[model samples]
Target chain A: MGRTSDARERILTAARTLMLSRGYSALGVAEICAAAGVPKGSFYYFFASKEELALAVVEEHWAGQRAEWTRALAGDVPPLRRLRRLYESTEAELRAGRESCGTVTGCLLGNLALELSTRTESVRERLREIFDEQVALVAETVAEARARGEVTVADTGAAARALVAQLEGRVLFAKLYDDPGRLDALWADSLALLGAEESQGAV
Target chain B: MGRTSDARERILTAARTLMLSRGYSALGVAEICAAAGVPKGSFYYFFASKEELALAVVEEHWAGQRAEWTRALAGDVPPLRRLRRLYESTEAELRAGRESCGTVTGCLLGNLALELSTRTESVRERLREIFDEQVALVAETVAEARARGEVTVADTGAAARALVAQLEGRVLFAKLYDDPGRLDALWADSLALLGAEESQGAV
Candidate 1:
């Protein structure tokens, strides 16, 4: 039982890393198994198909990310500051990814959304839900900021969507250029989108 | 000579459609040829390899898009209005694509950028150039708006990058949800990012 569970964990870890770099369609089961150092039969035992494995990978990555997001967004700092922390964490993560792998892998969910959303219905639905959740999390912060008169935007949901969109967009560029600095504008841009007071010290 | 050129065009058209929906790595030369109704031999004749064909597709699509962008960004209207026109055109294009294909295919360049940027260096360089041009084009409009005192953004280039990132981010949502209406917030969000006067008729 221990060996079986270990194989599953190994497969998930390998798939997450491979999918981050090469995306979904370009990878094969055999390649993932080879990277995981597991036999091909173990893959079938863990994942009924490559698509199933993708769902597992998405869930696993999101679980970790959601925890981080929860931590970043739920602190003693001001609402906007917490939101800024989210972007900071994202940038720091990208910088670390580049330093370790020599390339920016970008947001795995965003990458999979762009690559497989249209082609894979299951993945598409999951991505839509994940993005919706991301927007909602940001919206909660925006709402808190609004209650405190920290931001001028009337629609917190719309503002949150814009913020997430900006993050994804900048991350795309960061990956394309292999430079995490592309995300430097995210905080200021987010402040602008939220209509935060100029006193917020946006640059 | 006419027939030869026609075959090349057919391959490009098919590749663009396929790449938009299924992405780059998911496709094969034979499938593109089958869709183009050209023989497999004709594909190799027109392009050296799949990567070469992708470059051709990128150039061809950009050629058409660049023309549209130039037309949208140039005119007697205010720079902000020109920018709004560009977004309107994009929304219209997405709506039309959905009507015809029953799915939102998203931006071909963005789809490819996320899918191929890490695995394919040549394509990565080209996508980087294309996005840079996109930022530059938008920056020119922002600069014009700034000169007219229509906006207050101090860094036109950075604002342009933010605007484009917002665009790509929203478009990703549009594609993921299979709903073009996801882009309706772009104009308002953009004006906010630029710190345009509230008198500018934003949402």
Candidate 2:
């Protein structure tokens, strides 16, 4: 039982790492098995297939993201401040040079959703829910600021969507060019755009 | 000589279509050759390797984007109107309910740049420069809009980058969720965010 469980954890760990390096569809089962240092037979023991394994990785990754931003937003920082800090931390990660997580691989669920949506409706729905959850969290942050008279949104929901876009897009850029500064640049604008002085002041 | 030259065209044509369907890394030389109806010998005869084919595809794709956007932006339509119309067209395309293009596939070159930068300086530089060209053109358009009082941007360059992010991220979302509504929402916000509403006093 112990070894079997260890094999499962190892497989997930390997999948996570390899997904970051090679993307979801690009990485092969053989490569993952080799990377995990597990036997091929051990694979079916944990997950049904590569798609199932990928879904597990994506779920685990987003679960980590939810915890992270939730903790950050829940901290002493105000809503707008939390948003800025979020962008700042992402920028810092990019600038810190070279250690990016899988979330920065443009969101595994997102990448897969793009690639496999037609073929895999189950995965698509799962990814959409994750994204919607994250977007909801962002919207709540926006609304919190509105309630506090920190920012005014022309449309709170639209604003939330843009924030989500800016966040994901910035990461995509950072990962695209391998330069975190691109993220820093975009995030600064995103903050200013969303936090327009009048827009915020009036609200 | 003409027949031999046609083989090169066939390879590029096949690659373009396949890249759209299967993406860069997901595709192989065998598929391209088969799709082009060219022999394996002909494929190797025209291109040395898959990477070489990717280079060609990247160049072709970039040029096409540059040309398409340039024409769209520089047509008889005014800058602001041109942007609105193009986005409307994009919204229409999204409404058609198909896979989104590579603008969100992290910019195939951007994807290649990040994945291949350490591996190849040439690919990295090409991607950076190409991305810059796209940004610069959009910046020029924003500058024109600023001059015309069609838009109000404190910083044209930042606004341009945001526009690029908006476009790219919208595509990502569209693909990610397999729902065109994401694109529609993006276009709506895009017009609201970037389109300068004419002053009430103005005609």
Candidate 3:
């Protein structure tokens, strides 16, 4: 049982890494198994199909990210400051990824969302749920900021969506240019999007 | 000569359609040729490789989009108004795509950028140039707006890049949700990014 569980974890890890750089449709189960250092039979024992494996990867990646997001946004600091920390963390992750992989791998969810949304129904539904959760997480922060008179935006949901969209867009550029520095504008951009005063010192 | 040129056009069209729905890595030359109603041998006659074909598609798509962007950005309108027109046109394009295809295909450049950026260096370079051109086009208008005191953004280039990034981000959502209405926030988001007044008549 221990060995079986270990193989499953390895498959998920390999799929996430492969999907980060190459995307979904381009990946193959055999290649994923090879990258995971597991035999082909173990792949089927773990995932019924490639799409199922993709779902497992997505879930695992989001589980880690959600933890980070919760920690970043739940601090006692100002709401806007917490948001800044989120962006800072994102940039730092991209930088770390570039150093380790020699390329910006981008947000796994965004990359897969664009690549598989139209082709795969199950993945599309799963991504929608994940992104909705993300927007809600950010919306909670925006609502806190609004309550404290830190932001002028009226619709917290819309504001949060815009911030997430901006993050994804900037991350897209970061990956495209292989330069995580593209995200430097994210904090300022978020402040502007939320109608927060620039004097907040979050930057 | 006319017959040969017609075949090339068909291949490009087929590839564009397929790439929009399925993306690049999943596509094959034989399938593209089959969709084009041309012989597989003819594919090699016009393009050296799939990468070259992708380059041609990018160039052709950019030529059309550049023309549309120029028309939308130029003329007797205010700079902010012109920017609104650009967003409106983008939404309209996405809507039209969804109407015809029953799914939002998204900005071809953005879709390709996220999927191919890390894996394909040539596509990455071309996408960078294209996005830079897009940012430059928006920056020119931003500089104009700054001169007119319509926007408060200090760095026109950064502001423009933020607007473009916001756009690609929104478009990604539109595609993921298969809802062109996802772009309704773009004009508002752009105004925020540009630090333009909410009272701007553009919205």
Candidate 4:
């Protein structure tokens, strides 16, 4: 049982790294297996197919991202400040990516959604669920800000979706330019969209 | 010579369709030729490689897009109205895609930039030039709008980039939800971002 679990973890780790950098369609199962230093049989044992492996990776990556988001938007801070903290964390992650890989790796979910949405239904469905969850998180914060009179918007749900879209788009630019500054604009503009001033964040 | 040119045109059309729907890395040269109904030999006769073909396609697609942008942002109209026209064109295009393919096909350049930027420098450089051209077009419009007191912003360049990023991100959402409403919010919010109201257009 221990040996099987190790192989599963290795395969997941390898798939996460390779798919994030190289994209979903470009990276092959054989390449992932080789990168993980596991046998083909071991890969099959963990995940039935590449799509299945990708789904697992999406869930795992989202779990980690959700945790960071929860921390950044912790209830202790005011809503607008929490949003700023969330973007700051995003900037920090991009800097870390630049340091580690010499380039921005954008969001795996956004990348995969673009590449696989038309080609694979199962993956697309998984992406929709993840998108829904993340968008809901943003909506929750937007609602809180509205309740506290920190921001104003016609519809919190639409605003949340727009913010998420802007962030994904900004991340793409960050990857394209290989610069973290792109994210700063995203941070500022998103705050503005919510009718909040970045300078007025809570202490 | 004429036959060779015809083959090249066919290849470009097929590639433009496939690459836009799928992605840069997902579609292969063989598939492009087969879809184009041309022999593999003819594909090589016209383009040196898949990357070369993609570069050409990017240029061709952008050229068409630039022409449309020129018309939409015509100086005769008020700048804000022209910007509105540009986005309306985008919505119409998305609607057309939905009618033809039963789904949304995001911008080819944005999709390719996300997929190929880290993997291929040549493609990334081309994308940069294209982004610069498009963003310059937008900045010119924003400057015109600012001159006419149609909108207010600190930096027209940054605002233009933010708008472009928002549009690209909105396109991705259009693809993900397979709903044009996602783009509607993008249009509304982008106008809002510029400190301009969408309802106040030229008579």
Q: Which candidate is the best by TM-score?
A: 3
In candidate 2 chain A, what residue range of length 10 has the lowest lDDT sum? A194-203
Instruction: Give the range where candidate 4 chain A is weakest over 10 consecutive residues by summed lDDT.
Output: A194-203
Stretches > 4 Å off in candidate 2 = A92-97, A100-120, A192-195, A198-203, B89-124, B185-203
* Cα error of candidate 3 at position B16, Å: 0.4
lDDT of candidate 3 over B1-203, digit per residue (tens)? 99999999999999999999999999999999999999999999999999999999999999999999999999578888888899889999998988887899999999999999988889899999989999999999999989988899999999989999999999999999999899999888988888888887354
Local accuracy by lDDT, each model: 0.92, 0.67, 0.92, 0.86
Candidate 4: which docking quality band? medium
lDDT of 1 by residue, A1-203 (tens): 99999999999999999999999999999999999999999999989999999999999999999999999999578888888889889999999999887899999999999898888899989988988999999999999999998898988898888899999999999999989999988888988998887566332
lDDT per residue as tens, model 3, A60-111: 9999999999999985898888999999899999999999889999999999
lDDT of 1 by residue, B1-203 (tens): 99999999999999999999899999999999999999999999989999999999999999999999999999668888899999999999999999888899999999988988888999999988998999999999999999989999998989999999999999999999999999999999898999997666332
Q: After superposition, how far is residue A145 of candidate 3 from its true place, in Å?
A: 0.7
**Which lDDT value does model 3 have at A106?**
98
lDDT of 4 at A164: 91
Question: Model 1 chain B, poorest ten-residue lDDT window?
Answer: B194-203
Candidate 4's residue-wise lDDT over B1-203, tens digit each?
Answer: 88878889999999999997888888888899899999999988888988899899998999999999999998887888888788889888888978887788778888888899889899999899889888899999999888878777779999899889888888888888787667777657766678776565644
Worst 10 residues of 3 chain B by lDDT: B194-203
DockQ (CA atoms), all models: 0.90, 0.37, 0.87, 0.77
lDDT of 2 at A123: 76
Candidate 4: where are CA atoms >4 Å away? none
Model 3 TM-score on chain A: 0.98
